[model samples]
Target: MNYISAEQLTKSYGVKFLFKDISFNINEGDKIALVAKNGSGKSTLLKIILGREIADGGEVIVNKDIQVVLFDQEISFDGEDSIEEFMMKLDSAPINALRNYHQSLYSTDTKFIEEALAEMEIYKAWDLENEMKQILSQLKINDLSVKMGMLSGGQIKRVALAKLLTETRAEHRHTLLIMDEPTNHLDVEMVEWLENYLSKEKITLLLVTHDRYFLDSVCDIIWELEDQKLYVHNGSYATYLENKMIREENLSATIDKANNLYRKELEWMRRQPKARTTKSKSRIEAFYETEKVAKTNTSKESLELNFEMKRLGKKILELRDISKKYGNTIILDDFSYQFQRGEKVGIIGKNGVGKSTLLNIIQGLENYDKGEIETGETIRFGYFSQKGLQYKEDERVIDFIREISDNFPLANGKTISASQFLRLFLFDDQTQYSLISKLSGGEKRRLHLMYVLYQNPNFLIFDEPTNDLDLPTLTILENFLAQFQGTVAIVSHDRYFMDRIVSHVLAFEGNGKVKDFTGNFSEYRQYKSQQEKAGISETEKIAEEKPQTQKSKKRLSYKEQRELEQIDKRLPEKEAQRQIVMEQLNNETDYEKITLLSEKLEALTSEIEMMEIRWLELQAVLED
Candidate 1:
């Protein structure tokens, strides 16, 4: 069964032709992945199919009965409702019934509760509610009562995803799931969980993502959009790559053959006079067709990075007894490590586990509570963070880059102009002069990366650098980092990129525990799997053995004892703060102020819980 069919699709933006006369079909059970460069109209095609956008000269026919669920990169919400209220607004009967059931649990009216219960049973909303809760929990959305306005950008994306997935299941219709950059802003563990979930579910899917491991596992067909054309490969990502190479090679060879024939025809035409016979006219027409193929461009635009850094001294970065925390939440505790001159380390952990915080502390953007950090004189840090580059929206892309440096120095001492540097990063002449606000999200990320590389620093620190980047850019960046001469510390969720770039891994376990492994991410994963199979839980093992060695091998230091005392003093203050915020929320009538007070109350509650847990641990140590 065909879910959607598009014919002769032609679209353009200003003077640029995105695609011309393209045709495709999304059949039932087709798990497709659309791959393309940053600005290659992948999202636009999806919009056209979903009837959200109109094409210049084409029609998309979608089955009226099939349900389409789009997980777009930019979700639209007014940011005024709680998560439960937001979900209840969806047009799913089960969702509405479940919301009523939950509300009745808090109601004092017995008649309302009985009616709600009957509706839940009729709609089978109990199972839907359980599944929604599970989805929210796995995505790390613990506070459903919190307003949507209080969430971060990443958290908002996660919430949108959970809502979409739950809604699709509840509707009980034939689902055609379409996602754009679904893995963005997710940690590695979350990505893995999503991969597993999608692979197990029997839903038709079409998504645009740069996660190669995910594509290889979940998608069976590859849809490549390039050069105003669509090429379909009926296999996995690995097979698509191999087949694409073969196809390009064959096209080049055919073009070369056409050029030879066109040259012979040109000689014949130059020697003869104007043609009068029908046979001569046909030969002239054939000559023009041959010439067209001969002139086909086979050269592809590629991203190139070959910049050398300043010489590194013998002394590199070193941290001693580093400890950081917010109230009682420990980010780092006595974390000590000496980074070598040319080391590349990958940081891996769940979200909010202090990976980005560690990078900020190393760069001195954030302060540590207790630590001594030292760096060599030759070290110049180039930090690319998740906070992203702050740029004037109206400024031209070229002007933004030029503000950094008009010329970028290469490894061989040759310099390239700002325009040339932008071109190397796949920004064309027209795009260079365009406003930054007009660029795509991936394009902005690529531009920021170009700015970071232009500085020519000896030490590089990147936080979530692969979040919005396309696959081609990621491939070249990985190659460049593999040969980079300076030290690199990267916090990325891209497993393929991490496996290719890093030599070691730093696993940021929660509660200030950091485990350093002398191997790449793949190797570390294998080691972890082995440990799990052998029934070894690191946290459980540590808990079991800590009491025996608490007084002898490990004792609370002066700073730790002071930290315990501070937590004791702050717990009561945090509880009082929570009480005040709750009262303020009750008295507040303005929606905005209520949202703020609710956020404050949630923060205080979390802080108090952590402080109480830390206080108990400290007491246990003292008793030991």
Candidate 2:
């Protein structure tokens, strides 16, 4: 049975066309992933289907007597309220009854949590509130006593999602789940868990997510929204890729024929007078339609990476006797390693197990409680972080990019203007001057990434860089990083990306247990599964076991420790110099001199982190 069907859907914003006569239907057991680039009307179409927004033409017919649960992209709470209190407010029950229902869930006061599930066997009202807690816990939001307002962006998104899943899973009636970017704020572990849950559940789901792994694992069907049209692929993600490749081959031939017809029509139009007759007018409209199809750039062009960088020296980075603590919680302890050249390391861990903290410590953005770090003299770094590049709302794309370097040097030794460089990253001529705040989330991420490359750092550190970015951009970035010459470190939850880009893994187990693995995430999972099935703890084999040293080994000399302390002072100085050079590049007209100085300044900025680390690997080896 069909749950919903949208027929001849047409919508537009003034002169901008969003969709034209697009149609699709949802079946009773379909798990669909809606894929599209940023600002391509994915969210708009979802709103139209939910009846929150009206399409200019056509109608959506949802099956009668079916419950619809939605998890919107943007959801907010009005005022301060505890999580428990918030739940009670959402329900239309009496205070005492709602209180009992809330308390029975995951509370020691009663075994009523299970009893509520038994009560829900008859589909009672109270079970909705209590039964949903199972989902909330699985989503990793367990603290009910916490205030809703205190939740982080990711936490709030999880709360909204938990509510939606619980609502849909509560009753046995037909239901539809419409989710927008459902995996946007999820970690890898949580994303995997949700994927498993959705794959087994009977509810019909339509969700928009950029995580390719989630799409592949959970969805049985894929709906690609492109060029104001919908293309349905009735299989898995791999099948969708295979089918789309065939469709594109056919489309290219059609486009070539249309282009030829459009050119002939254009030449004929220049010779003929303005057509007033109905037949001639209809013919002119046909020419215009063909021209539009030929000129569409959507999904036709992919972004390119043009990286021209300085040579990497023998020295890279070293971490020795490094330890970090937040109050009483230990993060990293006496970690020691020497980063070699051309190594791609992917860091994996739970939400707060200090993967990002380790990156920050290496980048000299954060301080450690103990230990020293080392760096090479010629090292330059490009850090692409989720908290990257804070741009003012009024800032233009070109203007922001000019701050890093007014010119980008190509491998052929030719230089491109800042605006031209931005275009290569998919920013168009008109969009170069558009306000930063007006861009989509993925666009903003792309813009930030452009600035990261603008510095021309030889080394790169990315901390959760794929969070809000679309899949195409991620694909291009993966290709770029795979070919990059310098050492790289990634802190990402996108497991597919990790497998593709990195050769090694740094798996961070909780409680300051860090281990090095030899292969990609998939291999690590296989090894972990084998260990689990054999009744062996993963720690016994994989923990970062300190090498046994002789008792005669000497500790760090007083001079070395003092030099490590001086790194705390020198790092700030180098950072200040990089900022000054960046400002000068914005105003300077001398492109040649500016580019050289910008590279030197960036190298200096990275040296601050490297300076302190280089001390640990110096002539004195502090063996423990």
Candidate 3:
């Protein structure tokens, strides 16, 4: 049953309609990901659903007993409240119990103290405290007792999440947790932990996020908000993308057929002689109607971007025995890597793992200690920082672009004007003169991107370029990056962007090591998984390898030893059965055969899960 439904939803901001006539449904246990670019009404729609904001015109129907928890990116807590205090306030029972307990401490009368104790017993306040503490401990927020006002944005976000996790109503049916960019300020480890938690939980989640890895791991359905409509696909983000492409292809084919028919009709009309007869007039009218219908079905003209670069020297940049130290912390220790021209690379790590630091060092924006940094003489670099475009508060948008374009001349041997550049970036006359301070986050980012491309550098480095971009812009950028000829190095949490653009991945592992793999994000994940299976230490991999230490021995403890033996014992049997089921599923066309194969696969999966859990237990014991 649909837990929430929006019919003919229309939202407008001033003269612009953010979205119109949009309709979709969210059911219980559904994990939906709303993906769109900035200013695409994703947040607005969420607000509408939550009744925080009213749509211009629409009927929103929410099922009875459905509780929603919305985590807005702009959420802020007031001053002087500790994390514990805030959590208690989210659920009044805990707060009331705490209040009574405090009151009892001050009370001299035994009757009042006894009553307070009875109240605490009834509310189970001790259990709530224990659960809250456990949650804090799991989130690594135990030592953080600072007031909410004192916490960093990332820390506050964590505290908010912890409160939500602890304060959930036990009796609430069909709860929907809505999160907007929840991963934005989270560290890599925190994101992974959240993904694991969400995957294990049996709750409905509707999240709008740019974090592709999080989406891929957590979301089973993708709700793409594009062209003022919501498109639902039942699968992971990657599968959704594949299916969307197929749909677009089909649309293209339909348009092509219509165009072909229209052309044939035009040819037929041209071949016939003009007559004053009634039959000829009727035929002409019918042709005009068909032509109008064909025109309506035609595809819009999309921008064609091509990034073709000249061949560069073999070594674009190289780092040898590089170690970067900030205060007493060592971020990169004796890290060595080489970037070759025409190579597309992605840099990934948990937040604060020095991904940005490495990018800055490569861009020559910062210096590193104890390392030799080398770059090809002919290398022209383009850098897009994670902070995106930084402009003075009072700076005008036109002035910003003109300043960047001052060095470059237009095609007619004239100085490139700000208006011309703005048009290229999709900002028209009205927006050109607007204050940079007033521009949306996405607009500012787009301006920076326009500047980067206008520079026409050979080597490009982007740090989370997709952070605030809307879905349409992201699609355009993806296509542009795919065809870009220069060497590109990117640091992004968007796995889809990384998979589509990068050819290799350089993952930063904290404590002075970076793992280098010669493939995209998916391939790098596979490599990491293999490394984990082989028991390769990331720290050891980062350090310079000696001839003797290169071929490291794999040491297994007693527990691991037993588990490995069991896995070996079970593999052949499972593999034989798995192969037989796969063959049957592949050959079977009937529904019943397919259903039976699916059931067999499900059973096999259950067995695999059990084995994996047992193996993990053994590994944990071995590590201990």
Error of model 2, residue 242, in angstroms: 2.4
Off by over 4 Å in 1: 106-112, 266-281, 301-305, 535-624
| Model 3 TM-score, all chains together | 0.71
| TM-score ranking, best first | 1, 2, 3
Clash pairs detected, candidate 2:
373-612, 373-613, 373-614, 374-613, 374-614, 375-614
Give the top-scoring candidate (TM-score).
1
After aligning candidate 3 to the native by TM-score, how far in Å is the CA of 539 from where it should be? 6.8
Model 3: per-residue Cα lDDT over 140-226, one tens digit each: 687645788887766777788877766563323568889877776665557777889888788788988777778888999998876
| Each prediction's TM-score versus the true structure | 0.83, 0.78, 0.71
- Candidate 1 lDDT over 294-382, as tens digits, reads 99977665545566578899988988889999889999988877799779999999998899899988888899999899988898999
**Following a full C-alpha superposition, what root-mean-square deviation does model 3 have from the true structure?**
10.7
lDDT string for model 2 (198-314, tens) is 989887999887778888888888988877889998878789888878988888888888889989999977787764678878888898999987875534444444557777888
Clashes of 3: 4
Candidate 1 colliding pairs: none
Ranking by lDDT: 1, 2, 3
The lowest-lDDT stretch of 10 consecutive residues in candidate 1 is: 545-554
- What Cα-based lDDT does every candidate model obtain? 0.84, 0.76, 0.74
For this target, which candidate reaches the highest lDDT against the unseen true structure?
1
After superposition, candidate 3 runs with Cα above 4 Å error? 94-140, 169-174, 246-304, 308-315, 391-439, 522-624
